[model samples]
Target chain A: AQSVTQPDIHITVSEGASLELRCNYSYGATPYLFWYVQSPGQGLQLLLKYFSGDTLVQGIKGFEAEFKRSQSSFNLRKPSVHWSDAAEYFCAVGALSNTGKLIFGQGTTLQVKP
Target chain B: VTQSSRYLVKRTGEKVFLECVQDMDHENMFWYRQDPGMGLKLIYYSVGAGITDKGEVPNGYNVSRSTTEDFPLRLELAAPSQTSVYFCASSSDRNTEAFFGQGTRLTVV
Candidate 1:
């Protein structure tokens, strides 16, 4: 079935450094992709989504993601990482059914070092 | 202002109840309800009151949607393996984004 995979389990980056989190998905048809961020002990916050339009999508908190159809990937990126940017990131694919069910990736925990 | 932010329960044969309510009049409600492990697995979801469906991992868990405002999850027998943060979310429709709760850190020991 449909699934999402985030290759990196944990990543550490210095403050002000660029960041990229990889994500791959498996689906039968055109997939609806989304990126979510969760702070410690907090609920998930939507970062961005790619439904059908442009490959590059911008989201809240200065986050952006690119959906590559050929690679079946939706990768998140940030030009400059901040201390507050350290959080667990998840990539998800929406099921075709109208339930809005989402298959999520294992998640990548990003830690920022000063 | 947040609901079900944290829960700590002893591992007893007795049942554990998890409740969720949505004030936005959302058409969909989900329990499990977001990520804590490998990824966020949908345990159960309801389209409306009295209408619920199983999701990716539904075993050992039961749910009931009594009203549009309330969707509660029931664990028949609490187990240590059930120790994970639980989240509740709602959405207006399948195409729209879901709104999530602060999450409940359920620790079963």
Candidate 2:
């Protein structure tokens, strides 16, 4: 079965600190990977997606993710965190076909400190 | 802008209604449930105007397509576990990016 995993349940970082959120996935073929963020009582916003090409992909709000095929990981990183960056982050893997269904990992909640 | 409501509070055994309409001529519509400490799980989905499919969990929820422009999810009997945020998303098969609604937080006591 295809699945996505976010090892961290909660992470705390000081504002302006570098942040990294870990994610791993299980799939048979080259998979479509995505990162999404959801604020309190809001819907999810797409951060970035990796389909093919360069291992590193840049997303909105100064967020970037590195796709390591050998490690089966696509970890999200930010050079410096902002207070508003505090939100629930999710990692997802899209199905091979156009099922429009994504397998999501248990989310990681980031708490930014001032 | 797409506006998703903040929350919906309802009591157990009461019917809860959720409506989603997309201005975009999207062919795919989906409903997902989210809870603290967990990722979003797909509840139900509709491919086109009249095609609907139940997702991983569909025991307590029912969905319908009134038209190509309207898709609503209905919960006949609510439970404590049903108290979570529900998201509606729409997208065409050509566009991989799915557009999401603001989401409704349904609380069943």
Candidate 3:
């Protein structure tokens, strides 16, 4: 069984401020990690994913994540966030054995403060 | 492109249905289970995730998702446990990420 955990339930940041979202996963072997965003009354959108090779993976909208094998963490970071960045963010881990099922985190809601 | 409209929240012991249509002719269609304080759980996934397969969950549900463009999940007998937000997703390739539906919130008594 694989699982993902996002410690923060909600985070508020001012516009133009840097942002960091924490994510941790529990898996037996090497895990496939992904970050997704969901706007209010909207579907989930892919932010980024990490499979192999580089520890740091870049994603759309100037967002990036660093995969730390030792920490069992893949944290999403952005140098600056806009008001439009406010949304529900989810962290997911893919199954390697079969089905390619994605186990997601509890989700962190970002609130941009003006 | 993928778009899902908000469905009227249904109660328990009622029949629940949701349809997702994809214009891109995606090969993969998936249903994810989500609850408050819990993230999305893979319930039924078909197509590019290496064949059609459903995950470990409560039964009494039927899905005929043979077509790549249209996929629907039907709950013949909904229960209290089935009260959760359901999302449908589609992806063109197995390696790429999927686009998700807006999600339908179902409340079962």
User: Taking the candidates in order, what DockQ does each have?
Assistant: 0.75, 0.60, 0.64
How much is A20 displaced in model 2, in angstroms?
Answer: 1.1
Candidate 1 lDDT over A1-109, as tens digits, reads 7888899999999999999999999999988888999998788889988888889999998889999989988999999999999999999888879887788899999
Best first by lDDT, ranked: 2, 1, 3
Per-candidate iRMS values, in order, are 1.1, 1.7, 1.7
TM-score of 2: 0.93
Candidate 3 lDDT over A20-81, as tens digits, reads: 99999999988889999998877888999998999999999999999999999999999999
User: For model 3, what is the alpha-carbon lDDT of residue B29?
Assistant: 80
The CAPRI classification for model 3 reads as medium
What TM-score does each of the candidates earn?
Answer: 0.95, 0.93, 0.88
Clashing pairs in 3: B12-B109
Q: Quality of candidate 2's docking, in CAPRI categories? A: medium
Query: In candidate 1, how many Å is residue B49 off?
Result: 1.4
Provide the lDDT at B15 for model 2. 91
